[model samples]
Target: MTTSSSSSATHGRSPAGLDVSASFATTLHTPEHIRIAEELGFKRAWLYDTPQQSPDVWMTLALAAERTHRIGLGPGVLVPALRHPMVNASGAAALERLAPGRVAVAFGTGYTGRRAMGQQPVSWAYMTRYVTAFRALLRGETVEWEGSPMRMLHTPEYPRGAPDTIPVYIAAIGPKGTAIAESLGDGVFIMGIDGVSEEVTKKFESVVYGTAGSVLGDGEDLGSERLRTAAGPALAQLFHISYELGGEEAVKALPGGLEWLAVVQETPEAERHLAVHHGHLLRLNDADTAAWNAGGNTLVGHTLTGTAGDVLARVKDLAAQGVTEITYQPAGDIRRELEAFADAVGLRR
Candidate 1:
């Protein structure tokens, strides 16, 4: 998995009268990066589950756990389809042994993970089953899997036999996924806050779910050239996702959508996944940045890119909309953007 730092930082509130907290999200950073985030006062660190591009999430989290103290650490969202629920249950239990109460695991329907294998996301029913069983396994309780009853064999070694202390966060984009999260997960993980409807936010509020979403860029102005360059990779991913998931009409709805669609059409289908996620969480190349910039019209529609104050305003807006936490995911220079976001949100060491 990759690295993505997120938390419902109730330890303090921002200066905007919003109780929301700021955190960081990384896709391919080492434990040292997570240590820096902890020092920067981010309440938690999330590791993304992108096996196609990053190292194993559990190993990385283990390293982070060893290097940092006081910061919450867990997989931003682990794709259930990639591993057996029992295996993940053991892994989560092991991680909790290392980090104790600081561990949390989120489950996603497998976006990049499945795409890399040339497959589609697993069904909601399948995910629900996995989560239910996984939760039980973490509780060190016997659960009916497949046909017979099963339980973690080594529960006697650990006090609870499972990592019941770990919270499970569910990543959802639609009503079906949200419903699964509400029923089976302790929290909800969203990609971006723009598409989250008021009705959905109300549901999340009612459950007091710890919500986390991506904020793409940073600058002194919302429409600054620098902001565009910084936010390019994320914007490109959006375009690619729209085209890949929603087809030609969806692409048409985006800014310079048609042009981006052409870029995808020209590429061999097999390579599209890698191309869309190029420089992902790291840095975008000049050509990719230009293509992403060309699709800039759709940037503001979903991303939170602007001056510090602008970003703060957007954070306030999100908090009002019921988002308890924000995950700042910037491209280009990662530390510069992380420090800028920390400064903007008044999160100090």
Candidate 2:
């Protein structure tokens, strides 16, 4: 059963899920990756939606839909500012036509997408309105947008009609966003296990924990090249977000954070935003490599990396804490990481 529907009586453990970066390198192969996940018993495949850093989310999901039969497909957390509500509704509808009940869309306030463009996240109020409008449009209802009423106008021939129901999820990290999710969303997506609170576990039916790292093999050290290649992108992301949210002072507080900040600051101010997220979730860039060399290993404990048994223990702990699903984003060798994690979680096709 999918994690969303899994319960203690029905399953022994929480379901494992996969999240992929919709980068140019992975977009074409994502369909194959999702197919593998389906074969390995992964319940869902969430694609990243950062236009500046990767290809179109919907287009990539559509491709995945055509390739896989059972795995759920959707944007992990689509940024509301990137597209209008009508546009998002249409994309979700198109995917619904292809995947039917397998589609679920999650909306976020544009943390990475907006920040990469030298902007701040959208307010919670705007996100709520956008989600409300998108849902109404999917239900064949007219909603006022920018002082005018608009609705989905698709017929049976063109893009076809939207599915009767599409599950909505909200990506939340704090109380304000959690409140919005509790009010409107069918589930909640969080960055780590700590984000899944007692109130959230009770309020939301599905609490998906998103994380990135490798399942370390026997005798593998965090400082090894393989481990760095597999986990460095995610580690570097923390620095990127720190710099974006708190600027130089905040980033410098991290391990190797000072040197990382220095390298990032070397970029011209006008293009610094672009530099910060150059590789994003796909791989590490030059600045990231420098940070890793300086002292990034000190922050290894913060990631999901561990031996197979250790990782499994972590997953069980999260499940016990009411995290219904764990979506792991694998860097470097995607297939190897997926297989290792699936095995560690005892998933079967």
Candidate 3:
């Protein structure tokens, strides 16, 4: 399991939950999907930001805000390097006005957003500045930037800020990012439970889960073909991130770590992002599929696929592990997956 530690020291009350949420890449579906999620009783809706392939993140979220009520909405994890803090804060502020007290934002060191552009993830120092400045500006506080003080512009006509304060969640993988969240953020967003150390649960106010899930047929293997078809690309992306963040050892920790790493390594550095693009939910090549098959599923990196009861049990198991919020993103027909998973989880329209 992925583990993260939260700091005992926090600036304010932390946000906590034991609820379900829906996540999607902009191209996976549309804003209406968020409404469907809300109808099905999901507590939150998260949108992905992949500038090269997906639709505009903020407008999509705005559409979600205008169409839905109650369910929290925000980027699943906005890459700090892609946009300036002021720009990010302005978009969030506008969305908050449309849906006050119901919007949350998460920040991350660019992965898809950066890699797609043939760049590497930004420095942790840059990520910290982006998040810290974004938070301060959202609160209408002045923060020094580029050798000058900057604050998100506020006007009576627009009120570009959250209701009281916009809740912030930082996407963390290793110790450094988690430590940053523990020290500065209101919550932590993680890809798997393995990253969540026992120490983290006690420190952060909220923990948001990110996972690839699909319904399973009877007697499916841990590395079932159906799951591979639906969520294989996502699983591939998981290993890709592991290798990118922590190198070979980290990728080895994944279900199909070594084999997949080999296939990924075979690709040219300029084309590396393609190996994990398109939400990494599907469109894998034969070699990649073979590598994935060679590596069986594991505790921390398996797709959520099973009978309704089985899926529910898995979700509960995660909740028991201090997962305050689970963001489910299926890899196939968005509506069908959402409806099925929603039903399986006992969520009703």
Candidate 4:
């Protein structure tokens, strides 16, 4: 199973707040999942940015807004390099208009998946620069830098200076990426597999979430603590879930497959993802292993897991760390998953 550095982090390093995170499904049923997240009391719902299988990011988040209230939403993460900052700015502003204070956008530097679209991975500095500029433009401010070319066909009706600046978060993992998040983002959505420790993440979370305010300025609810605690555990658990089941099948769905098992066991210092692939492979079978692994700590860290008590425990733990919001994306069961979480958390009515 996958786990986040937040959980792996030591108590000394754990942050002051914790927020929830979730993702949009790629299928037609996604809207339904959004509704379920709302009903389940998950405060944040995320729409993903996969080129091949994912749905339109802004449209999906907009669809979600129409269906629910009291829940904040945004794209799980759009690649900063793929679309120009202007387009990203416009889309984010549009989303803010739709959900107002409930809107926040997260970006990721190009990942393995973005390459499918002929997009190259972006440097951390560039990603930071692009996102900072995008946030500025979204707030209805003028920016000096020129970003890549982009266009948004379905723009949100401008609120005409309704504080159009929606919070912009980045989905980053690893030390270099985390440093970027701490430096450049309002918050971060961390990803993980079994080997990565929650303690490692929580230590980072404590620092970032704690400093979100001084860095971003004002809006505690919109500050760093409102950011996520970490990612990975939930996805690992998903591998152990019902539909996917926990076996060799699930292992193959992840990155390494058999290669992970052979390498990770042999090499501790081997590439982390390679180790994760192996750990996942060892923990599960191929049929159940997810071929795709992407999310803003939403699918893996906060949603889809053990008992209601287990979820409550996880949520509370993060909350204690100062996470004021928890965006829930129901990647698991729409009805049962939400129902169980709502029952356990008592946040859902």
The C-alpha lDDT values of all candidates are: 0.67, 0.78, 0.72, 0.49
What is the C-alpha lDDT profile of model 2 across 1-349, one tens digit per residue? 2224433123323343322221122466777887777766666788888888677889888888887766778898889999999999999998988887778888888778888898889999999999999998889889999999887888657653555578888998689999999888989988752355777776777887788888998898779998888888878877887887788898878888877877888999998988888888788877888889988776876778899888878877777777777888888888888888878887742
Instruction: Please report how far candidate 3 places residue 21 from its true position, in Å.
Output: 0.4
Q: TM-score of predicted model 1?
A: 0.83
lDDT of 4 by residue, 1-349 (tens): 1124343222111122344444544456667686676555454566667645555777777777777656667776788766777766766666666666677777777553354343446788888788777766655566767544333333354343343456656666667787787777766664322123354355444321210000111332211221221113234434333212344565445443444334333534323333333222112223223321222123333233444555566656656654444444333334554454455555543
lDDT of 1 by residue, 1-349 (tens): 2233334344334664444322333444657777776667676677777777778888888888888766778787789889989989988888777776778788888776787567888899999999999998878789998898998888355644238867887887788988888888776777773355667766664222232212344324444565565666555666667766887798778777766666656658767665555555445544345555675534654566656676778777777777766665555555666677677777763
Candidate 1 to native Cα RMSD, angstroms: 4.6
lDDT tens string, model 3, 59-166?
898877877757778987899878888899899888888887778888887777787677888888988888888888877889998899987677787677453377
Q: Positional deviation of 63 in candidate 4, in angstroms?
A: 1.9
Clashing pairs in 2: none
C-alpha TM-scores of all predictions: 0.83, 0.91, 0.82, 0.60
What does the lDDT come to for candidate 2? Answer: 0.78
Ordering by TM-score: 2, 1, 3, 4
Summing lDDT over every window of 10 consecutive residues in candidate 2, give the lowest-scoring window: 16-25
Highest-scoring model, TM-score: 2
Better of 1 and 3 by TM-score: 1
Summed over model 4, clashes come to: 57
